[model samples]
Target chain A: MSKEELRMHWEDSFDHKYVKLKKWLIDGMTNGQFRFGDRLPSENMLCRKFDLSRQTVRRALDELEKEGAIKKVRGSGTFVNRVFAQPQRTSSVGILSTVLYEYIFPTIMFGAENILTSAGYGIEFGITYNKVENEANFLKRMLEINPMGLIIEGSKTNLPAMNVDLFREIQRKGIPVVFIHNQYAELSDIPCIIMDDVGSAFALTELLIQNGHKKIAGIFKFDDVQGKYRYAGYGKALRAHKIPIVDEHVIWFDSYEWLGKEMNWVFEEIAECTAIVCYNDQVCIKVLAEMKRRGLSVPTDISVVSIDDTNLIANLEVGITSAVHPKEIIGEVAAKTLIKMIEDNTVGNKSYSKVMPVEIVVRQSIANRKKMEKHHE
Target chain B: MSKEELRMHWEDSFDHKYVKLKKWLIDGMTNGQFRFGDRLPSENMLCRKFDLSRQTVRRALDELEKEGAIKKVRGSGTFVNRVFAQPQRTSSVGILSTVLYEYIFPTIMFGAENILTSAGYGIEFGITYNKVENEANFLKRMLEINPMGLIIEGSKTNLPAMNVDLFREIQRKGIPVVFIHNQYAELSDIPCIIMDDVGSAFALTELLIQNGHKKIAGIFKFDDVQGKYRYAGYGKALRAHKIPIVDEHVIWFDSYEWLGKEMNWVFEEIAECTAIVCYNDQVCIKVLAEMKRRGLSVPTDISVVSIDDTNLIANLEVGITSAVHPKEIIGEVAAKTLIKMIEDNTVGNKSYSKVMPVEIVVRQSIANRKKMEKHHE
Candidate 1:
């Protein structure tokens, strides 16, 4: 079938001017009117053929391109996705989260579902609860369901490999897999949507430094990929400022200890520091509590800042001056990426990795220490 | 079947002491070994006959009762649930929440899932995002699915009637409905698992009074059922202590406006109050930030107390003294009740309404104003 034939079919398929042009493209591809590697009608050609706006034509083409149903080259016309042209559309995508309905997962799931549903896909979720047994159970269920694609927010991305074989098996079954939040260390070839942890942390630490604080202590988690990047960023900011990165000023703890009894020691160790750089809002909030317990005032006796500005943190006593978490956008991008991989049959290819941008949120947590010193003098 | 025959079956079912007795009971009914309203063997008789521990027998019976497979009448033997006798087991229950990922919802959902899954039921969640349209959409979807039961965390419980007809329709389909956190005004016949808002708030306010606070101001949300109860409790505490509930000291705002510019007015209005009683941790945190900006020291220039002791409040600049939210227990109780209603086919019979207890968390936010006055003298 030629481009002209496909154009005629699209125009004849509907009476309304607002006919779904994207669906027509998919229908053409499935019926062999547009075969693998066949060039789609140019945007202007599509607009003229269908009597549609250029914007409408481009939008349809863009969606097709996004889902791997079509790929656009800089100088060449868009081609049908070689992988997606043959298979029928799968009704549902499977999503696995460590803990559903908690912290940021619900919003992420919500965002993903909104986009996926609009694109004619349903979501089936399984909870791993950050446990190996639960992970195994969910993986087994995913295998049974054999969903169109799988999106995993792994239970512990840094742990010794456990579900590597299962994930590999999923890929072997022709199901696309995309990881979010944390990716498995062993599966480096898989596409991932991860945070710009190092850059965001570096920016956050630099913000504190720019606020005139020299003695900045850090409270970080040591059990995941994010913690390492955040800690390194803190060190980088200190090095750039020519401030000594003292070993005793750093407190390395896991998620379990944020509100745990070890908080007393964390506060005691950071006593002499003028500013505190925390890993996330949960840790920062705990540090603030400890500061209050010791009769220390925030941004006065000591300043504070962290990464991931959550709602709880935003509405806190000082509305934590920190970095914003792009959870919704991450979900949307990750969902779109996975769907594209599924459509194009590019699940096994190590062709995509996204590090979404993070921005600073200026609140009341940080203080100008130099001004305080001047006032004291 | 006779008691002897039932015991014989139980003994022959498995070798492991930790056998799945609940499945066996369901199987017995399906296979015609048990019938509707048939009285089962006494716990002691079953224990003696099957050579099983009384604890195991009771445990199995307890689960059967929760799933509405049986009922234990005082001074009589346990009888099979009449409604559960004929229908095949439904594997899933639907849950709807206004927002699923924020605040204390994650923990509540976690608790509910733990109980439901253990009892062999799956959860299908719908998020209303606190919008009427979304609520209607979810309700329509739930009706199409015709789930075994429904657990609703309403969009906005205090709003004018919108979902009452949909809820009534669910009951008409013979599907049980249970509400959590808040209940709709028109659906008085449905069971609800709500917080003891008034009692908890009274306790919190009484605590502040005991600590020598007389001039107490409140920042409350007026758009939910819980807020109204909490406000009433606050008033009750004030009146009981002979402290006037001043009009200017009370600031009423909605959930949408908590982080809005109206907050500036909230801070400005509460300037003269020595102690501020907040709606929840989120509000308390905001109030604290405002105090910091105005150079008012917590427990010194002013004191604070609030409802719902969340992680944010626990780890604040001043660990807010608060009334705890029983979200987890509420979820557990609500899920169990809904399951019972589903199994027993009691969709419209008002058999349950639970108000889970709340306790006070004494932290540093509340100060002894009388003691401070004496010290200054």
Candidate 2:
């Protein structure tokens, strides 16, 4: 079976003989005909083996690649598709989020990716940009990559038809998936890593109270899992302390992805509260930047504290007081869990949850409320 | 061609004939037999027509997939591979870097990704993490994803053997890969994007001199390309002003990545200079953080400026005056050039290079040299 012989067969055959070869290739992968990083013989080898031409052989391999069948490593050669190659180790989970370079997502995702990668499993990532279609598309690609488990940053509920389809496909394919930060109650079977929002909010709020700040302010993002939880915590903390939660004191914005349009609005709201708690580190960073741009100073005119602990925030020019979540811990657990499910195919219908302990790091962002009457918008 | 017939064909010899059928499927895609986004007939359709079983029919179709042949949408019928099926206008370009999330990588990478994505071309990304293995691995993988071009963030001069082999393979395959941020000046005829370090450094130093900073302090990373030009610039600027740069004010931190282990030697030099211009933003940020950790304030106690215009510096609590490079434009031009090479396969034998522009953003980090002396350690 050589290239010349194969070209002749293609001309002679009105039969669909190619389909059988596809199964053979897949069976070869499942049956260990190829190892994870092993590149198969060139199309020439396959052509000679099967009396086929180079083009015919390549066509067969190409489709497997498209169907998440194999990974064609250019220059190195084509290898067995790892997305479906090995039995997934709990450490080799995949993550798909709407954004990768955000304040919170990285904090959470890096934790998971690092833990998993350290445990000898690789983690591949996809970004969705908060769009349902993109999420669905990313989901499809992730599945084709054949990760043992998935950790989606946002809730799977209220998504578009395509997103739902992707989730359904993952389930149908028997792949385990996890939701993180926030989730839908109805999706209880899906494991998740969530923050203890109400508790954290209450704790920080009490800190403000103990600092003698009655006119405290809360600034956060809206329409997100973490944002809602932080807000709820703010409210619960206020109610428990017998302090009124004034809507005016709560200024809201979305994720840092689109933070600028609301800067002016935040300026108008700054005059209302003695102290401010930002939703995450990025918002706090932006607030500080904008305020400086407008010739305003922090702690002197307005005291501020933020949530989210990045590697460098503690040592920043302004020591930011923050509630830090153990992102790496959560990431490791998710990877481990997904790997377990992939290996045994028995991470049964249970919604497991892990909440890493969070504590506030007191920095320079907060101070006792001052009697300032010269507040200008 | 139908399911019933394909099942019958499974019992036949699994040989050359299957290869032929696979090519026809591909030929169909190339010949406009199946339009872009159009799904081929079902497995069952092939089964009946060829008198092959579901298994055998799949084998023939499988071969059509492996070589970038086609895309098989789950639940939907398999579609022709976009390489031949879809037009190049819908194609995407990719960006690959080592440790993309670190220091200035993300800021520069993001700027590039944003610009490319906004231009109606999809951008795919990969992080090589300064590892030759990872770099080589990603280089192959990036090519497999079929990017029109690539923007490599670091110097290829440092790549390991395997990576070098693969990179050469990329050139052999006629795909254009452009180097950015770091220069490949030694390698004749390598395509690259670079900053005017000699000119910019001279400018940066002139700023320090103009601000009355004769006893200037410098902490730098001693990399050949940027470090060489920058150091030269500083010397040239000093010569122009009839000022001598005291060697004591110039301290070379071999790397910030080494956790400042190499910086112990620099402690003695900080107090000598009134103003310190750093090699890059990462060094500047780290030094700033270290200084704060040591209870020193920037600009007030010791003025600082650095290279690289990343948002990381912008997000810093105190703004540092620094040179900003045109990162996104670099990415765009690199990608466009690579795409051209990939398409025309007409890369010249000589290396090509493009020098990107830089801007000096004056922030609060730099102050008059005489004023900086008051706060010098």
Classify candidate 2 by CAPRI docking class.
incorrect
Quote model 1's TM-score for chain B: 0.75
Instruction: For candidate 1, give the DockQ.
Output: 0.01
Against the reference, the lDDT scores of all candidates come to 0.75, 0.63
Per-residue lDDT tens digits for candidate 1, residues B293-319, read 878888888888888788877766677
Model 1 interface Cα RMSD in Å? 24.1
Name the regions of candidate 1 deviating beyond 4 angstroms: A1-377, B1-90, B348-350
The candidate 2 chain B region of ten consecutive residues with least summed lDDT is B155-164
Score every model by TM-score.
Answer: 0.40, 0.37
Number of the top-ranking candidate, with TM-score as the measure: 1
